[model samples]
Target: MAKHGFKAIEALDITYVLPTYARARVAFVKGKGARLQDTQGRDYIDFGSGIGVASLGHSHKALQKALKKSAKTLIHTSNLYYIEPQAKLAARLVEYYKRGDEGKPNTQKSDKSKWRVFFGNSGAEANECAIKIARKYGQKDGRYKIITLDSSFHGRTIATLKATGQDKFHKHFAPFPDGFVRAKDLSDIPNKLDSETAAVFIELVQGEGGINALDKKQVQHLAKILKKQNILLMVDEVQSGIYRSGEIFASKVYGIEPDVITMAKGLAGGVPIGACMTRLIDVFESGDHGSTFGGNFLSTNAGLAVLKTLEKMRKDRTLESTTKYFHTKLDSVLERYPAVFSKRVGLGLMCGLQVRSEEIFSQILSACLRHRVLVLRSGGNVLRFLPPLTITKSEIDEGFTRLLCALKELKISQTQKTAQKSKNPK
Candidate 1:
């Protein structure tokens, strides 16, 4: 049943019920740190970090300990009763958010104290909660429009999908929920605001939308406009938070404190949890929103562990320093490849390279795969690189070596094509 190096039984052993994922040639059976080992006993550098979810890297000791310990003691304890871990985790997060850069005073006041936290199971659900919050916030006076940026991505839910700025996702799901508007320019956003507009949802950096970051000046001006118009400003930090962007939240990097913020990936160091935090405290009623699995004891404990790790990183200044170091190194790499990439964008470790075309990006990705370096593509023509915050300099150097080799191979292939054409003479 083995064909050449591949096993045909391995290919046809399973039913065709599962969906295909572009069908990678290799199968990884184990992973540690930033290296993944395939079934064929090959190791690959994991620069994608499971699409930016593996913040602490594969099977981190602390995260594993927390999960195992929590699983042994208790698992699910529905939302009906009090959960100490959930309460403690919430307090820790609120404390951290209020304290800002640690030891900083609680700058968010008592009136804004009306703001609260909502938990969910994924990025999309977190965004869905945000959509509900925005809609409810506007329901008081018939406001319902949410302004999302063009080329921006929120999630795949019906509401968030509608809120997504790309038309490609709107396929087959026509007649999406109304009240979502797209604005090309930050200057043109004010015209879209009215009594019916509940909030303006924005991604400080459009992670899935080619890693296009918003201009700080434009963001500040837009925030001021929203504040003056009495409209809520919601930020989707689902992919840009948790020190992935060098800062705890992209909001901090952009210098704009949104009224509402959503987060999920890398929150629990790979555990499934999504959170929506907002400055608008009194926007929801007792029965307005709920989730069965949100803030469960196990997930909450994982969240606590993640926060503890982050606290340690912040105390040692590793989070900030690592992000800066990664950014600087990636910038250097971009400078070296100016011919292949126009520029690099993004803050901290969440960086992207603007390649010549989608085909070029795919070729680069394939080349990385061949060299055992794993990276993911974003939008159409950008390669997103989100390695673990704890990745070592040696590992980074190794990854960059693989990347350089891949680029060299691509050049050789291009040269071969040119030579072949010159010899063929049409």
Candidate 2:
């Protein structure tokens, strides 16, 4: 440790941090809408979008301007007082669900009720907020358990890690707080919920758990049942919201108006912003919960910019058509790799493929990076593609082309490995 204690560490010193992330070799130095460059100046076509945080893409002009403006004026302040940008962002999200485009809904009186939003720093924090509210809502009734679906992801925080349904995330952190349990299956939700249940949390599309999408009919059915029972229905749109799944939120696509919804990852473009929105009645009292840096001036400004950008995209219908074209291109690519991919799944830009084997999946991922096409992996096997919503049809085509080349390289490598094994007879 040196004097001037906490200065930023250089790349060589990154090992000083916790070994939480299995970081990639290359460090991106700069980026454009759908392109990125490493510190070595090597260019790459981006499909991962920084795991969906770069909604409008890296260093977008709007984001830069927003950041600069906020920095010049106010970057952060306490949440004890009202922040204009924070309130505006919350209003924008509420209005999004209340009214559709052009100030019209399917009918005059839909869910025009009030919604309150709480901001946080990341997806996990947003989810943690949701869990706390849910738990608090049941405190008087002695109901605190939350029901989450199998293979669903909440976040990495202690409360959220416990809320997550995957067993692998439960290890090495023994004794996760009580009140979180996993459902046996979608068909078993009704039976699994008990008097101790406070809420049912779901991801319309399980982004980290292989981008698995819940059935619309079953989801709506469950929502109805929960509503009648006065149980809260919560939707976690951390990876599939902010138009990533063709709609403002996949919850909108599912047509399920949940009592609570948590969103992040792409809310403020690349800026760190997470929010938990819920019905007015579901909101916690002032002393129940609060965040120190949540809804700060900077993040709220970024959020406002993102909402404005998303609204413009919706008006132009660019994301809709781009999403359609992306799926079509991915279809052609999948058709060519029948044996490597079991099937394709997902909606809008949140697409993924079911790999035939884990080896092929890893090989495909490594090849994509080597070929200058960035992507992500999910569920330990899926090749997840979550490009910026601003990606154009041509960009989608180009990215897919690069991905196809990587796929070829993977197949060739696998073939060579097979040959070597046969020769050695090992």
Candidate 3:
């Protein structure tokens, strides 16, 4: 960790107890929209978007009001009672993705049944529920193996860590679940499938896997193959859902319907809530998987508010068009610095730029911090941009100006080093 000049009390040694995060030096005390203020009142242009959780931006009034009102009314009831907010939120969510008419829905629906929701408190928990459902779905047929892509990222839980395709996350957390298999590409999946295979899980855009996106054909083909094999299709949308990818869900852009969808992060506008919404909601028994605080009154209220705001943003074209404009500006800026950045990849606001090396990324990140612009590194060598969907053109231009100035400084530093090396005859 790069040490910032903040003094710490010996009593505040909790950081040593928890795992270390690649955190910035400055401490943020307040945030609004796309701007954050540090302890010393220095302002920063936030491109991290709280790691893709603040879709409506920090401290949104809608979310705040909902949270406060719900808190005053009721916070937790242990899921024993029929919580009105939870039921209402789930109904709203189902209506958003419900197919056909109410009585004559689709093939997945039962004659007398409705879509069901299983909620949790975080992305990992959401994924854990999906994993459990998939396992049970195939437990009868002896099909338990899960096929994930080479560069896909799911979550940090034991099941999700095993589901994660990158080998780096698998270190030391050995002896993961037995039914997981990693594939180089979708074609590699066919060879790995057997009677023990249960489902295929993937990230539409591999956020931690360098922000690389699967080809539309690759995804569609995988979905087809999984359907043929009776293997469930699970899309991990924890990072890509809730308008982060311009669409409400990344699967919409890919033109595929997953059997199960896991969503979190932006679901509640920074409040902790994760959910597994699936067409096959009846696969698991009632006691197979559950959570105590999953769909409590407060979180559900916040989720409803968040969804309403996003739906409004989507209809008004404020979120999607703004994100598209910002992406275009990013591409134009990157074209002017091709030597420093080779390529950029992403969909809408969920974007990443691949730098030449980890060293370059670190240098640029340090420079961004110095200039009071906050950004995050994704998939080792790419700088991920998760700016608020509500950010304006002026904010984009200002952030880009700071970023370009940092790049220019790095370029000059490299040139000076080359000149010094020539003079020293090394």
Candidate 4:
């Protein structure tokens, strides 16, 4: 054990690891469900869920069992061979897409045979695959431009980064891959579209972009327009999929059938896996795209375990009830601290509380950390909450209790600072 707690680990990381992230001081060593324990042995209520990747929570029994079982057997093999776990996992995802299509009288029932899956290692890879499909599908017609909504975040790779609609990420990455256009809004999308338009990719709930969920009616209308024009509609469900939006996919919540859907983050309950599911399966030939580690034995089995657990939750309506309870808790918090919070944004367990300003957000975030509660920030001024799907009511209550204490402490500190400023008059 290190004598200096996280400081020793921090020193080693700073020395050896690339400094890509401005990390918090704490170093978590263990976690269970909605709670985490730091190297110092201090407990914390986890609301960030590693930015919404731990959907089934940390060290879940199902995931552990699957990992152990897969490790004892085979960890990976070439994609050339038919992997049962990978095939099963892909079929399961397609079934989920089909399940969302049920009971819609006006909509055509999803044909399982029409859809196909491509496994990858991250959301960026999945999104890249989706973009490739759109580009390839449009190549015959010379249409290659993909329209994305402003404030949207796609991924970090060169292609996916170009697909991101935010300007901040565009800086420093010069000469990005072409064929991506940004639309200001639904109205502007029509103006942005032309003969070169191949697809309109969007996140139903913009998780990293301040948790802003697009209006359902506008999205439905956009989908209709895109379909009429023979343009692909891609949905990036990396952060909002897997019951994060109270549905298997956020696209289902919006009631729009996307031509391509990309998912990662929570798909395998913390295992590194991503998937690109598309109806246009013929767009990519066998040699068009491949991943050496994609759909490996361990990852696919982990995904299967996560799917099984989530299926049970969906069947028992545990996911539905929990989502409702979470929203209710958020509503109560917003009501209690009207002045501190501007509004609540997002859907289901994927939520954000907009603060009065960025400074206030930073203060509250630091206070939350000080109070042994781990949270996240998004879109500069939003305090994002992405607790595990398995977070219980009592855990929610406890988290809120710590949050309220942080708010009170902040209030007191602000009052003192005001007094000091008045006295100093500098």
Give TM per candidate.
Answer: 0.91, 0.92, 0.91, 0.94
lDDT of 4 by residue, 268-318 (tens): 988899999999977888799999999999989999998888878877888
lDDT per residue, candidate 2, 1-426, as tens digits?
222222233444575767678877777667888998776677899999999889998888898999999989999888978899999998888888786645465466655566788998899988998888888887888889899988889998888898888999989998789888789667788998888889999899999888898889999999999989878899999999998987787888897889889999999987788899898454576677778888999999998898889778887888788888888877777667666776788888899888878778778888998989999989887888999988877777778889988887775455645654554453
Compared with the true structure, what per-residue lDDT tens digits does model 3 show for residues 1-426? Answer: 213324452224444545356446667777888898876778889898889988788888999999999878998997767889888887876766653323233556442135577889999999898888888889887888888989788889888999999998999999988989888987787888888889988888888988888789988988898888789999999998877877677887787878888899888988899988888867887577878999998899999998888878877788868987887877876666665676888887889888766666778988999988888888888889999887878888888888887776674357645554554443
Candidate 3's TM-score? 0.91
Local distance difference test, per candidate?
0.80, 0.84, 0.81, 0.87
Clashing residue pairs in candidate 4 (N, C-alpha, C atoms within 3 angstroms): none
Off by over 4 Å in 2: 1-11, 101-107, 412-426
lDDT of 2: 0.84
Which stretches of model 4 miss by more than 4 angstroms?
A: 1-4, 100-112, 411-426
Clashes of 1: 2
lDDT of 3: 0.81
Error of 1 at 406 (Å): 1.0
Model 1: per-residue Cα lDDT over 185-274, one tens digit each = 677788888778989998888888888888899899989988888898999999888777766778877867688889999888788899
Candidate ordering by TM-score (highest first)? 4, 2, 1, 3
lDDT of 4: 0.87
